[model samples]
Target: MKTSYVSNLAIQTAMRMTIQQNQMDLLKATQEQTTGRHYDVGLTLGATASRSLNLQREIDRLNSMKSTNSVVTQRLSGSQGALETMAKAAEKVRDTLVTYKGNDAASQLKIQKTEILGALQTFTAAANTSFNGEFLFSGINTDAKPLADYTATSAAKTAFDAAFTAFKTANSITSDDQITVTQMQDFIKNTVEPMFTGTGWDANWSDASSQNMTSRISASEVIESSTNANTNGFRMFAMASVITAELMDKNVTPEVRAAIGVEALQYVEQGIAGLNAERSQLGISESRVKKANTSIDAQLKLVNTHVADLEGIDPIETSTRINTLKVQLETSYTLTSRLQQMSLLNFL
Candidate 1:
């Protein structure tokens, strides 16, 4: 009787130990399936979190770059349009000046002057053109006006209001001369140039020179003389000074007038070349922006892929693993239930 009791006690103890071991194994398997993380305490949580955060930061950086590129592209497109208008206006001025010189009649000359002045006013307005409320040609000083207002009777007004009105057939000239090439240039020099010294637009000026006419003209006397020579305020006085004195004199022969026309054409050609160069430079910048955007997009895609690898789980694989864990857990519970029914009498 004593031997049988001892045997039963030893068997019961062995059975309990086996059940406890199975329960612990089942718990570990369930945890693995539910969490998809291996049971390990040595894994570096800080390092994993830092890597994830870094990828997110990179994604944010690329997004910001894309936004900046879009703005620059828009600005560059508007600038291209403004440049085209400027080139067209400069060409028209040259043609009109040539035609005016060809005709010996003072009446015709006055008429041509009126037409040229009107064209100049139109060009000046265009030069002070804006994109999204910011002046396109005002360098980096978008807030400052590129052209100053010149009231018709103001001391600085050089062009005749009567002539401009006759040409336009409308009072679009208003009661003011509006603005002139010289004043506009001066405004750019003083306000716009400094802000753009090391920027893309700075290359438009000669050498490292400031856009200021005073610095560019060098000789104070010559600058003053050119300014005084401009009887019409809308005239580009510095450029106009290139025309020989012999060609400008009212008493000069028809031959001299022809010569002056040729010189004026040359000057116009030079101005066109300069504007074309600027347009080309803008084109290059636009191209660089496009390339940069493409590169940024590629980087963002790579980051996204890496992030998915880190955090995103495959649904099919996860489902399969969970089902396997459920089966194992159910089998362990069934075994534990059968063990509870076992006793010395059942064994006998």
Candidate 2:
């Protein structure tokens, strides 16, 4: 009787073990069929978990760069457009100055003044361009407007008035004889140049900032994200614009204004030249950003491939495994059922 009871207990224990194993197999097979991946990633890639984790980290970084690059690219494009606008306006100023200086009719002079003022406004507007309400040319001070308006009461006009007055006082004469080309040269060198060079110029006015903004486009690379209004080329453009307005003011004699007009041509040429230089620089930066974006995308793709290899299962193989597990489960259930039917009456 003791032996028979011991045999029954052993059969029950074995059946219990078989049922538990079958349940685990069914659970694994169900997961594989539903998800098409091995249910146990830790078991499959335990040896490479460290490497897989590292690659995942890199992938995360690349994704972050992609998000940031979207906005960076837009800012760069906006900057480039703003620069082109300003450069074209400078060209217009240069062309109009040629026309204005050539003809001295009161009607044409008045018309040219209107045109110059319009160009000045264009320059101001270009300098103050914003993307999403943030100033593009304000450098790090993106919240600040880059240039004040060109009205007579604005800071830029006030600086010009003060500098022009000082220039006239220093020369000690107001006649055409004292305001020849030689005098124009002297005035620019001693007056306007100083205003741009020394602390007096930037201190008194100059709304445009000298600050530059930079961005990290890649892990090891940083690039300038924007250009400022206070660059040398931009400064020269401002000088030419201011000179055009001054010449149009008719504050001096016709002959004096004409001579100064000739002198102003030099500034117009320099400003145009400066515009070209700045545009070239911006073009190079744009190219760098494009290349960096490409590199980032490529890295993400390669890293994701590595991650799949490390932890992912083949769909075909997982399907085969699910079938095998189902067959084993059916066999285990059949055997457990037979064992559960055993009894002492059958043994007698």
Candidate 3:
């Protein structure tokens, strides 16, 4: 039989290693208890760690979508407000035209012209409204102003002058009042009307895209998120306002004035209808976004519950293990102390 004697140094070293291991276990158990989660998820989950990883990725994705949805909702709300402002301005001008139709009284017609011009200015401002540093009515061209200002120096004003000058030259008329009701209607139909369509609008009035903006509100759903100034409603509003403001002060008879008022009112009504339709379409998209968020929230709750179950630690069991580790550390320390005292020199 071979006998080997173990030195106190070796015994103390082994006890110290055990104490160190117990302290580490105690720290891990305490963390698990406080966090209510696994401290070493990969180790504990082992083969199923991939499942936890995938679920966490899903949570991140859903959270990102939710954040994006919040921005989309703000944009939609801003668009709705701009449309509402435009609609109200149109309605105010329409009412003024209706009330003062055929009056031809300089004061009343002047007031009516002022009202129409104001509405046009309001509409233009609304059309060019911006939200979050982007134009609300610019469609995909959000970085640029949607509608050109109808100022004296603006392209829209220059185009209108050219169109009207051509109309006067074509009819061989020297003055606005010399123009008959039939001639005025012809000018509007053939000249002013055409300017609001095709390349004319794009070149002179609108910088917006005919194609509106679309957004993904959910994983599988996408919808039109914004409307553009190039829509018929916006075009009609500009047309009616320009005609009323520029032609109302003409030295024409009440009959001609009435004819112009009638034409403008018709255009204003059409513009109102167009704006209402845009609002309706945007409202639908807003509703869909809200519903998508609700669904996402539901999915988040379910995914979080599964994640909790997968990575959760039992507080009671972790606390018990912590206590056991503490007791073992204390015992190791006591044994180490005894070993330190058990030197052969103490016996001598």
Candidate 4:
């Protein structure tokens, strides 16, 4: 048997190295115990570590999509609210028109004009509503206000005045009372009607785009998230309101006023229908978003569960390992202290 003498220095160095290693193990075990996840997933799971990483990435992607969906839902809700306000205002005007159509009593006609003007103002306000600094009815041009105010000095009012002046000059009518029903009808058909359609409408009335805002509610599903003032309904609403408000106070015959009422009432009805259609489409999108969120929630739960299964650790096992490492580290420290005291000088 070969006899070898072990030096105290050698034992101390070995014990110090063991203590450092135990400390590292204890730290890792404590972390694993607290998080219930592996400290070194690559070493523990080997080639399958990539699977856990992929699942976590999927979770992140889903979370990002959910965040986006939240914005989409907010925009949709705001759009719906504005549309509701517009629809209600339009409905009120429609009721007024139906109740007083062809009733040319001076006081009654004045009341009707006042109500129509007020409704028009309400419609414009709602159409220009903004959310989060974006105009709700501006379609994809969210930064721009959708509708121009039809005030006395506005371009729309100027254009209408010019159109009416041209009509009167063409018809050789010097006075407002000289405008007969036939002349008025001709003016509306040839001049007023065209102003609210196509380029004329764009130039004078609306700053909104025809293409509405679209949002991706899910990976595979996208939907229109907004409407604009360029729609037929909005055009009709402005047309009816403007024509009645501008012409009702003119010194025209009751026959002519009654004729104007007939045409405006028809336009108001059409406008109401158009607004209803827009509301219906938006409602459908809202329902779809709700369903998409439900699906996303389900996907998130499934992906997170998979990630946990792949990276999870046994808490009991990790805790036991932590305690064992702590004891080993303490023993090493004690041994190192004792070894330091056992020098040849001390023995002497």
Kindly list the per-residue Cα lDDT of model 3 for residues 230-315, writing each as its tens digit.
Answer: 89899888888999998888888777888888899899899999999999999999999999999999999999999999999888
TM-scores for the candidates: 0.53, 0.79, 0.90, 0.88
TM-score of 2: 0.79
- Model 1, range 245-304, lDDT digits (tens) per residue? 212334445664565556556655666666666667667666766666777788789998
Model 3 lDDT at residue 219: 91
1 or 4, greater by lDDT: 4
Can you tell me which runs of candidate 4 are displaced by over 4 Å?
1-7, 98-112, 336-348
TM-score of 3: 0.90
Q: What is the lDDT of residue 46 in candidate 1?
A: 44
RMSD of each: 14.0, 4.9, 3.0, 3.1
What ranges in model 3 sit over 4 Å off?
Answer: 1-12, 326-348
Error of 1 at 238 (Å): 7.7
CA lDDT scores, all candidates in order: 0.51, 0.76, 0.90, 0.88
Worst 10 residues of 3 by lDDT: 100-109
Question: What TM-score, to 2 decimals, does candidate 1 have?
Answer: 0.53
Compute the lDDT of residue 312 as modeled in candidate 1: 52
All candidates in order of lDDT, best leading: 3, 4, 2, 1
